[model samples]
Every structure is written in C-alpha cells, then in structure tokens.
Target chain A: MASFDRHRNRRDNRVDTLSDTAIEGKDPDFDAWLSQQLQFHEPYLDNDGFCEQVMEQLPAPSRRSERRAARFQYGAVVAASAIVAWQFPFDRVWMEALQQSISLYSLVGVGILSSLAAMTGGILAARR
Target chain B: MDLNDGDLIRRVVDGDQRAYAQLVRRYQSQLRFSLRQLCDGDRGLADDMAQEAFIKAYKALPAFRGDARFSTWLYRIAYNLVMSHKRKKAPDVDQEAVDRARSEESVEEAQQLGMARDLDSAMKELSEAQRQAVHLCMQRGFSHEEAASIMKLPLGTVKSHVNRARAKLQTLLQAWREEVVSGQL
Candidate 1:
C-alpha cells in the first residue's frame, strides 16, 4: 500500500509537469503523452481463418439480382391487376353477387382468401 | 504483382470470388481492429460486426463506385454495423474490471495495465461520435477528411469531436504524465 501511494504521488508529479509544459506552448510532451496512452490500446485482432469465415458467409452473388428481379415481377403483377380491375366489369359482377345470397362481408372475405391463395401459389411456383 | 484495390474490385464485380477473397484478406485486420475499438474492446462483438460488414459489403459491391478508397468504404460499413448494434444493445464497458487491473503496484506494471484501463474508461466517457472520431483519426491515423467521410459527419463536426476527445483523454490519463515526470515510467 505504501508503494502504491508513492507510485501514485510520482504519477501526480509527472502530470503536473506535463500540464505546465502544455501551458507554455511546448505541447510536444503532452502530445507524446497522449499518443503513448492511445497507442497502448492498439488492438491486434487474431484473424486466422477470418477470410474463410467471411467467404462462407457471403450470399451467392446472384442472390442480390434475384431479389431485384423478384421486386420487378411483383410490381408487374400489381400493375397488371390494376389494368384488369379498371378495364373489366368486375364491379357489376361484385354487385350482382352482393344482390344474391352472398353478403358483402362474404364477398370481401372471398377476395382476401383468393389473394392469399394467389400469393401462396406464387411462392410455391418460385420454390419449384 | 499484387492487384490494386480497384482492380480487385473490378474482378470481384466481374464474378471473380477469388478476387473478393483477396479483398477480404487485405482489409480484415484493419476492419477487425477498428471494430474492436468501436465496440470498446469486446473482441467477440467486434469480430461479429466485422463479419457482418464483410458480407454486407459483398452484397453491396455492385453499388460501390470507386469514389472512396475501398478501405474507407469498408470502414464505413463496419462503423454502421457497430452503430446499429449499439442501438440494439447498449454496450457496458466494465469499469470495475479496469479498476481492479489498475490496483497492481509496480510502476511498469501499472503503466501497462493502468493505461489500458484509463484509455477504456476515457473512451466510455466520450459521446459516441467523439469516440469514433478520436479512434479513427488519432489512433488509427486516418486523415480528418477520411474519418469524416467514414463517420458521415460534416468535416467541422469530426474535427470538433476529435479535439474534444483529445482534451477529455488528456484529463483522464493525467496520471500517466505524472508517472513520466517522476522518472518512474
């Protein structure tokens, strides 16, 4: 403990000297001190097998382009759906079905189910 | 002759996985070290972030214009990953462990161990941007402009962070200078 306190006192004196030097505009000592302290933490990462690990983790190069193509396909499908909805007499068919035994809620439910079915089919087709 | 980074990048873009591997090997240490510092000396987390950055870089390689040096671009990716990770889980720098390490007696031993502790604790005290700026510019020897680009901060902000970080570090590690003055270091 005595040794520890002594060491601490010595360190305190050095800091005072450097602080004075810094005030005098001879900052080289302070800069050197800062550099030494910072350099002490320079990390040397052990990188054996790092390259192999990264290589294994990289997605197949085509995967990115495939994702882009998938987006384009989805967009085309949406555009085609809008054109068909606009051009067809689907509103008349929907109203007629509503006038029949089918309630409006049932018709809406059916539409949702069919959309889900189409999405499932599209996913299955892509997988195949 | 070793291919320059641009050539390697061109080959990788042209579907040469070997060239990509070379790029990975060339920058792995640098990226890993930067991540380690950014992660506050958590080696495992640093390596994980580095790996994620490399994979992300590979996927985004096509979008990489040759505007920035490959290293600066890569560092940017790693820095982003570190920042995202920090958002998910705030990393706790173990100051107690650092304090324990500093309790050792010999001046040489204390200098070695205390400096590490002081630096780590000092770093933890810094704002995130300040820490990144200081590590990139002061420790890693990146030019202020390069560090600014990597951090995506305005040049003035990066400069301010570096200066403030240096001042904070000086105050934190004043004992080291004291040790030097005492002729004990």
Candidate 2:
C-alpha cells in the first residue's frame, strides 16, 4: 500500500533534478513542500507475484500469426491473379499491347517488376 | 544489457513473449499503485484492472506507435478501463478496509500520521478528475501536458484540476500545519 512514510533508501536527493519549471508560477513554498512529500509518498511497490500472474494470463503470441495471415492473403491474391493470367489469351493481349501505346520500356519495366515480385515472394516464403 | 521500454515493446510486437513479461514486470507495481488510489484503495479491483489493462495493451501492441511514452499509454488504457468499470457502478469499496489501508501506521510512522491522514481524507473529497489530475501531475511527477494526454482532458482542464486539488488540500491540511507549528504532531 502507498503511504506517506518515506521509503528510507530509495531517493537520495528529493529535489535533485526536478526544477519543476513546468509548474512555476505561485506557491513556491507550498509546491516545494508538496513535491518533497509526494516524492516520498510511494517509493516503488513490490511486485508481489503480480507480474507472474499477468504473464501467465497473457494470450499466446499473436504478431507472428497476424503476419502469417497477411502473408497468406498476399499469396492468395497473387495466386488468383496468376491463375487468371494463365487462363487469359496472353499472346493476343501482348500483340494488342505492342500495337497500342505501350512502349518496349514499359514492357521491360513490367517484366522486371514481375520478376522482383516473384523474388520477394520466394524470399518471404524461404524466411517463413 | 537491460532493454529500454521501446526495445522491449518492439520485441513484444515481434512475438517475444518474454519481452512482454519484462514489460509487465517493469510497470506492474507503479500502474497497480496508481490504480489502487483511483479505486479508492481497493487493491483487488485495482490489481484486476491492472491485469486487464496489460492484456488489452498486449492485444493492441502491434498498433502501438511510439508517439507517447509507454507508461503514459498504459495509464491511458488503465484509466479507460477504470471509467468503464465505474460506469457499470460496481459496489463501493469496503470502507473499513479503505480506512485501515489509509491509516496504517507504526511507531516511527506516527510523525506523519496527522498530516498524512488529513491529506488522504482530503484527497478522497476531491472530484475524480481532480484526484486523477493530482495523482498524475503531483504524485507521479508528470508534466501537466502529459497528465492531460493520459486523462484525455484539455491541458487547461488538467491544470485546473491540479490547482483546485491543491487549493482544497491546502485548506483541509491547514490545521495539521498549524499543529506542526505548535509541535503537536
């Protein structure tokens, strides 16, 4: 329990670094006294097995699962896109893209981006 | 090396259960003590609230941007839980237990008995906002701005709470001061 009794050894100098400029206007006397009193009010309560209780009650590690779920979503979307592309008439689409405003540089850029995406997915899976 | 709170938090967010245990250990006492005061010295309820807050923070850890101090953020969670608990209108704390907790004393501790007892009772008389503000700013040594953030009150309102709380405490404790002057306590 927190009480006003000073914990004998905790704080060496009660006013060492508390310039208290944050609250500086009036009642310097009373403020300083109150500060001293409060500094001594509750020096560090003992753990008393509370930490163990909290740790025991904590739900299992979740960030890894969340990450795994996000990766799975990304993989699923990429797989669906791949399936759709595989079913589409890619040669005609390429011919149309070539005939359209799409430049050689744009095609090369898309190819490089696709390769990089595949590489990223491979690295992520390897790490997993 | 002892990891700082930021490192511990990052580790916890990366699925390090032991890192989170370290955080719970580091903050449990201070958090619980503050909750105890807010719960009117109901240690059991305070402990329960503290536990719940830690669990909530754990579930929300991945989203905890380091915009505020970890302790302040934890306090905000605990304060919110306290507010909801109060809204449910739980039964009042055992008054006898509260009095005994507040007035516990020893031979050497008797020197502060008069002043401490008066301050404790006077603190109970304060509005909840005033009490919280005083605790965060005065007792915990947080700046008024930090207290405002924790309480989700305006900066001016927090300052007013501290000022009003102090004014009341000063008045209520005047007799105790006079007695000290007269060597009565």
Candidate 3:
C-alpha cells in the first residue's frame, strides 16, 4: 500500500506536464515551443468593449419615478380587483332584490358573512 | 465603487441598478479575457458572449444560492453561453479553412495561428463531458471539485474527463504539428 501510494503521488505530480508531452508526442522542445506560442497569441485578441455592452442590456431600476410608476400600476390592479370582488355580492343581492321580495335583515346578514369571509382570507394570505 | 462581487449581486437583487453596473466594471476585463480565449480571439463574438453572460447572471441573481464565489457562478454562465454559441452558430473560419490559411503564413505567424487552431481542434475533438471539464479546469482555473459543482458531475468524473481531454489534445496537437510542418494539414 505504501509503495502504491508513492507510485500514485509520483504519477499525480507529473501528470500536467507529462500528460502534455505524452498526448502531444512532441519532443520536450516542441512542447516548450507550443507553450510559448500560446503565450504570444494571448494578447492579440482585444476584448475591451465587453462590459459596456453588457451594462446596456441589464434592466435598469434607476429612478424613484420608475418605482413609483410601477407601484402605482400594481396598486391599480389590486384596487380594481378589490372593487370588483367587493361589489360582486351586492350585485347578486340587487339582482335577487329585483326578482322577488327581499328582507333587509337577511340581505345585511349575507353581506356581513361574505365580507367577514373575504377579510379572513385576505388576512391569512397576507400573513403567509 | 469598492463593493465586492457578492455584495454587488446582493444589491442588484435588491433592485440597485448602480451596484450592478459596478459589478460589470469589475468583471468585464476578466470576462473578456476568458471569452476571448474561448472564442479563439474573435473580440466581437467574445464581447457578445460576455454581455449575454452578465445579463443572464443579472436576471438570475435572485436565484443564486451563494455556494460558490460570484465569479465562479458568472463564469459558469459565460462558459455555458460560449458552448451554446459554438454548437449552434457556425464559425466564421472553420478549422479546415483556418488550417489552409495557416499554411501560407511565415513560421512565426504559423505558430501564432497554429496555437489557436490546435487548441480549438483539441477542444472540438473532445467529448462534451471532456470539453466541459477541460474548459472549467484549464480555461476557468477551477479545481476538479469546483468543476464538478459547475458541471454537476461527480468529482471523479470531472477528473477523468480532464485527464482524458488532456491526453487526447496532446496526441491531436502533436499530429497537427507534424501535418503543418510537412504541408499535409
């Protein structure tokens, strides 16, 4: 096991350079030459303009006005939905009132129960 | 101005656009260097790829789990984008055409041209797994373990691909040298 460990360590230590040579089959001279060539080619490629282009495409959350506008839009939707939901039960009751005789107490009771249920649901969702 | 990349990402997630710009300035150079290497010195393509990477990273900032360095996470995005570009879009100068062009140049020019061709050839010849391992390890300077995370591969598998790709590239590069010298490429 000790001998095996020693052999593995030796193999691991030389792997990068040795592998470079063995796989390339170039003499050590050619390997050295290629390495130099790689270094030389490194600088010829210009890549300076990368950042500005990327920055331009990023979604800008720059201004407070934008935030306010977004918030207003969000609030408008929520308010519209709330208004629709609030008026829906009453709309049904009004239709029922037109169709037949209605008791004020019964209509008030139904409205109170529906409003309570909606309030409870809204509160639960908000907590979550 | 002096915020680290992680801090910038956090700020960006919190809707701070200026912090995002600062992050871009800090990483743009290194990203370009990495992309230039991957794109075989086509600065325009490298710039496009780097831009896409940053935009993607920015959009996905909220989902970043912070397990790796922000640069590592960004490099993973860049590497994936480059790989997709290579696979989907045809190269402007394909290897055969580039080799033909290389044959006409002086020895030093040939050497310069050959390095890119050889590296490109060697990289292209690799299996997808092997290519990814070599890209993460050699190109991005990730350790095998780090590459495993980026690649979502087992550590041993990443190690194996890196070893295999290195060996194969050595053989292919050596053959390439002989061919170029003999005018047989």
Candidate 4:
C-alpha cells in the first residue's frame, strides 16, 4: 500500500484526494486499485500559456452586480417619481401657481425683474 | 490572495478579469485533462473545448448562483460541450443504443486493450457516461452527487454508471493490483 501511495505521489498529486471508504458501497481495495490505474493514465498538463490565451480571447467579465444595482436605482427613481406624481396633485399646484403669478404682487415682482434685466442689458450694451 | 472559487467568481461577476483568469488557471489543467479523456485523447480538441468552456463560463458567470461548486459547474459546461460536439459530429449516433451495445463488449475489449495500450485506451471503451462518472468520481475527487451535478445526470444514474464502468474496467483493476504487488508500477 505504501508503494502504491508512493507511486501515486510520484505521479499525480490529486490522486487519493479522498480517504478510503469515502463513498458508500465502494470497495476500498478496488477503489485504490482503480485509482492507481487511473492515476497512471492521468497527466498533469502544464498551463503552457493556455490561461493567457483564454484571457486574451475572453470578451470581458461583466459587472452584473453593478448593472443590477443601476437597474434597481433607476427603477427606484422611476417608482419614486411616479409615486410623487400620483400622490401630489402637481397639475393643480402648477395651475394654482400660474393663477397666483397673474396677481398684482407677482406682476409687480415681474415688472421689477424686467426693469432690472433691462438696466443690466443697457449697461452691458453701453460697455460693448 | 489565494481566494476561494466563490470569491474569485464574485470578483469575476464584478468585472475583475484577473479574478476570472485566476479561476481559469486553477481549473484549466483538470478541466482540459477531463476533456482530453472525453475527446479520446485528442489533446487539441480537448484544449479547444476547454477554452470554449472557459469562455462560456466567463460569459455566464453573472448568472451563476453559487448553488454548485464553480469547478463542478465548469465541468458541466465542458461535458455539455463534449456531448454537443459528439452529437454534431455524429448526428445519427444513438448514444443509448451505443451504451447498451458496448456494455459487455467494452469489458472484453478492455481486457484485450489493457495488455497493450494500458488504462487510458481501455477507458475509451467505456461509454461516455461511464467514463465521465469514473473520471469525476475517482480521479477528480468529486462525490457521486457532485458528479451527477456535473454530468447533469440523475444520482442513481451516475452511481450505476460508475458501477458499470468499474465492472467493465475489471481488467485494469486486476492489472493494477498485480503491478503494485510486483512493484512494476
């Protein structure tokens, strides 16, 4: 058995990875014998730049989690926007603001802003 | 860092190409070796299939749910590739009938071939299912259930495949024991 083990060691390292009787109903002797024969045939193929070749040919690793997170974030934003749109009467608020803008105080503020804009434009035009 | 397969796969999902490369380096030998067995010692075909399997695994990495070991999943990919290649190459070959027809004949041939070409060639006589079961269960240290997962076969089917394969490869078993006793191995 020690010689068998020695032979296995001299061969592939991964042989005998499991203990004897690792699998139920498996004959340990038969398992060892078969494993040894299998080991004899098994070769530890070198990488030989295969990894690099595969890497070079790989399309790219996808950032799935990032994509998923982005999707969730976008979904949440849309959902939030929809909720706000549904929960708040934005149309009514807009109409009310528009109605209020037509009042005297808004007209006075607009007139002041218009006068200020005209003064600024006149000063800039004069400088030019 | 010597990260586990899970961590490496996680990194791969997160767009770390180096992590996927590490995963490839870790399993390429064993996967290629297994594919070589399935390819009937066609190393080029095995390497090509192995490369394709790795690329497919990389592309499908994000969908991997960590339910099975990464290596097992990768083996499953490789096995599917081999089976698909076989199907495409021999579209009319009935695998079930071939398995049944070769069950007894494989043993007889293994005994004869074991004398000349040794174990690997004798292994070729076994049906693809049995050979895959033997390779995964014995050489690769996967449990029967793990092998079933990798082969995408039922557990009982995988177990029976291993049993039937060992029965067919009885010649190799005897030759091995004899060689070990004689220190010929």
* Best prediction by DockQ: 4
Instruction: Say which candidate scores most in lDDT.
Output: 2
For every candidate, C-alpha RMSD to the true structure in Å: 17.9, 12.4, 17.0, 15.4
Between which residue pairs do clashes occur in model 1? Answer: A11-B178, A11-B179, A14-B177, A14-B178, A15-B177, A15-B178
Q: Residue by residue across B9-32, what tens digits does model 2's lDDT show?
A: 977876667889899988888899
TM-score of each: 0.56, 0.62, 0.48, 0.60
Candidate order (TM-score): 2, 4, 1, 3
Colliding residue pairs in candidate 2: none
Give candidate 2's whole-model lDDT: 0.74
Select the stronger candidate by lDDT from 2 and 4: 2
Off by over 4 Å in 2: A1-25, A63-128, B90-115, B171-185
lDDT string, candidate 2, A1-128, tens digits: 13222321232243233234423336656666665666566658788888888888888877666587567667766786678668968688689888896987888799779867876776576446
lDDT of each: 0.72, 0.74, 0.66, 0.72
What does DockQ give for each predicted structure? 0.13, 0.15, 0.10, 0.17
Candidate 2 vs candidate 4: which has greater DockQ? 4
Which scores higher on TM-score, 3 or 4?
A: 4
Across B1-185, the per-residue lDDT of candidate 3 in tens digits comes to 48777787766775667777788877787677667656665656767788888899988887899988888888889878987788787655456534543454334344545446456545566787877676667655677888887666798888778766766655555544656579885
TM-score of predicted model 4? Answer: 0.60
Please give the lDDT score at residue B9 for candidate 3. 77
Query: Tens digit of lDDT per residue, candidate 4, span A1-128?
Result: 33333433453332224233333335667777777666665657899999999999988444676576456555655565457557967567557777877675775587569656655554454333
